[model samples]
Target chain A: MTLPRRGPWRIVFVAALVVAAVIFVIPFVWLVSASLREPGYVFSTGLLPLPFHPENYREAFQAVPLPLWLFNSAVVGTAAAVSVTLSSAWVAFGFAYFRFPGRDLLFGLVLATMMLPFAVTMIPTYLIWSELKLTDTQVPLWAGNLFGSAFYIFLLRQFLLSLPRELFEAARVDGASYPALFWRVAFPLIRPALLVVLVFEFKASWTDLVKPLIYLRDESLFTLPRGLKVVLDRFGVRRRAGLAHRARGQRHRHDPDDHRVLPRPAPLHRRHRDHGPQGLSRARSGPCGRRGRWPSGSPRPAPPWSSGSGP
Target chain B: MAAPRRRPTLARREARWGVLFLAPWLVGFLVFYAGPMVASLWLSFTDYDIVNPPRFVGLDNYRQMLADPMVARSLRNTVYYTVLHVPLTMAISLGLALLLNRVGRLSGFFRTVFYLPVMTPAVAVGILFLLLLNTQDGLVNGFLGWFGIDGPSWTTDPAWVMPGIVLMSLWSLGSTVVIYLAALQNVPRELHEAATVDGAGSWQRFRSVTLPMISGALFFTLIVNTIAALQMFTEVYTMFFGNQSTQQRFDADASTFYVIYLFQQAFQFLHMGFASALAWLLFLVILVITVVQLRLSKRWVYYESEES
Candidate 1:
């Protein structure tokens, strides 16, 4: 029997959905408004900008090497995604198509690796990269991925396992080589899973800040996330006077501003004014107050626990 | 006898092909994952500062963690995030999925709209929230102003920092919603129809019928979401402590997640040994929680194949 489709239920459902939809878009709408906002007026409460200044995008490009950062992100992300997709597909092909001794046990190990936390391996990996002289370059960012990630392998294998065994057997009976079958038949059939791997890796590489932070030291090599972090730190709402300096730099100089947003080499008034009288006094005291300490002058205090080189 | 003879040789040939095809992952597994994992365990006992050779210091780092204030603080913050984030995300995602399922014709369009936020990079989302949650001029606070309510200083105020993160985490609920929607679609319509005939109201029918059918997906999302929430890092890192300025420290207590603290120990302070210990500790915690979740799931999670 057909149930009543029209009633209070329909109205309530529509109303609830409309509210949820608006909530989902609020941050996005604000991002657009803030990005288009006037240079100094970076924060905007409205959903839409009143006096839309699209020039902030231009200023942002000039302020940091936006195009270079995007290019770096693309190169790293694309390389990692491409490598991961190819390698994982190759590995998955073997697991799906073969019935070898210890295959199940080996595949189990692969699955186990997915749960292995980055924290456990990050330090040693960094050390290995440093030893190889791969640190401070983009090599560390995508090098590990050239082998393949466990999740992608597992995902592709599951997809491969679901396919009819007859297809592979037929190809093998025709005297097709394993690699030839993988390229001609398996690869085309598993396009969707491959796309998922590619998209996931690309997004991951694009958004990653920690890897770049741990590895890349030079400004020229920074990806978009790292570059954005630099921008936010230098020019967030708390630091109003920073925009003033940028504004001045735009007017006075033909060359790019030499100021790197570091602790000013000299404690100039511009730096002190932002921190106020109390901050200036702390800066004078040499130790710099704990709340406002910059790592530049004050060497990081050794943790109390580090005194254990053995008695 | 002839079939058995051919089988052995064919199996041998296939195994060889498998090994050849698997070479890339085999090399990767050895170099990237397995080697580093073993090295990490060893390094956890030695004090290494890339500049100098590691000096052996057995249990010192682990012992020190027992007294580290930041360790306690970050753990508390991480647990707090996981506890709130997982359930809230699950509820919101399921709710959105239910709503979208009801709005059957527009599911495709609405699904894209909802999923867009998940596609945006986490860094961009974090940066956007930094603006949206600004105390004075943020859209969130602005909207609050409409009701004559003053919003909390979200990122700046320690009290509101976790809530701010929780709010930001909700923006990416689109992925989870899509998963739940897929599960909902797979729920047999005949069951719902049967429930309706039995005089069960919509809500009643949902509670009794739909819930049990999609319990497997529900359980999967819950465990995955919980694991992710425990490892919350990138958004909080970019939003709060990622200072490129000479002063790398930002004293936002509520925002100091466990992974972030571990990262600071490893990279910022060069405490490689101590950080490895922290990493192992985190892994142990995750392993235990996952095991507990699996044990608990036996009572509630429904498997269709097991029914017969």
Candidate 2:
């Protein structure tokens, strides 16, 4: 099964590796290039930054509460990671150390929960939070982790099982309390698994848009992903805003250097209050263009002066 | 019962301690999982708006689902996406793992390059792919144009939307690649050598020896990926429905997945009961699919323990 060390086979192998590497890396290059362009040139076909406008970063910062969102995301991610790690580890230790009545059945129940879709419990869970008067608060986002996620419990339990029973027994013989047995003996041994749980849960919390979309309505309370959703709503979807502004014969006020701009879409403050149930209906009739006029329906609008052609 | 009047046995004492340690999860199970599950099942039979008490509707919600066009469309869309996504992910990951397994010192670098996208937040990936999949000026289309292929309008076309999503999902197949790589490394070299001595060519060795050796990981990933693909939300939602303002502009019917429809029912339309029914339906689908997969695995998946 080993690749031939020398000849045309080695050359082909290297070429394949290089091609795969380029395919994987190019999207990131395109992302950085697009981010650097003047907002007008974002959709312009390019894989390289020729005329970079670093000011776009500054404008984006001023346009949105990016710092506040980052802070909120960090807090939520840390809380979720730390709580799930600690709680899942504790539960896993119990499963690993003790042979109790109905233990196998209980463990099976825990594993079965992994198969249950979150959609089933989502509505009831929301109702539970609303009943506790905690809806729209950050508590709903990370507080559930205190209960220990089933997946993490199962993962950490597997790690704990690999440890020799004699190590725990030795500690018990030395008059260690049960909690002390876990803390002093098993805890240190499973540090790597705990770390894995921490990282995974943190990523889960950080990337989570649905939970925040469901729970948080306040603008100031938004995590990074939720804030990004708002950003996409305003800027990402309607790339034609700049052209529409120029066609209307009004120069955007703030930047004399850039004529290809319009005033920021509806005030951020307006959206803050309008995120209620009524907002859902309002959004149905929002200012988005008609479906018939989608970019795909018409000929490719000649990339607003394409500098980088098909690269 | 009378025998229990004696001092607690060592085993009983240990069991008490075990229960004590398990208290947090026990409480969590009651509050978060068991309680909500029961409530969800009950709510599925009632008409519930958040403001008012639930009115028992006696299976009307389930009956509505039977006639709901959107429910059927969403399920079809999910199944289509699952069929496309799960196999592609598994195959590509296995391919990448095989490639990586052949490499020597540069393996870690390639592995990291592949896994990096998995670490990127799904929302970020969604946004990035939205830009990359843009019909006219997108990087993907641009790449295709280099090959003289006319790229379809990925996000806007109903026919191509699921394929677009499948492509985006493949970017995060790095996790699966890592899993497959682990499994591949665990395949005993002696088995391959033994096969080679028995007049097996490389392809024959791969088909006979490599496939079965890694079938457990393959089966595990198949089930996990199938379940995940069916439940897919964050990335699809971010790319397609993140903007409520422009949500209608896209091919809504085509891209509307089962979970998305469920979310709409529970949250947007306030059809909480209907949403619960939708959830239960999904649960049953998953249960049936998993059971079938396990059964089918008996024919193909070779376990060393079973062989012994």
True contacts kept of each: 0.50, 0.48
Q: How do the candidates score on chain B by TM-score?
A: 0.95, 0.96
- CA lDDT of B299 in candidate 1? 94
Which candidate ranks first by DockQ, i.e. highest? 1
Winning model by lDDT: 2
Q: How much lDDT does each candidate structure score?
A: 0.75, 0.78
TM-score of each: 0.88, 0.88
lDDT of 2 at B235: 84
**RMSD (CA, Å), each prediction:** 6.5, 8.7
Model 2 alpha-carbon drift over 4 Å, by segment: A1-7, A237-264, A267-311, B1-9
- Cα lDDT tens digits for candidate 1, B1-308: 68869988888998998998888888988887889889988888887655456778898878888877778999999999889888999998999888888765766877888899988877777777765776666678888899999999786667888998998898898989999999998888888888888999978988888898889999999989888888888788777665433233334566889998888667654667878889989999999999999999999999999988
* True-vs-predicted CA distance for residue A145, candidate 2, Å: 1.2
lDDT of 2 by residue, B122-178 (tens): 888887887678676677988899999999889788998899999999988889999
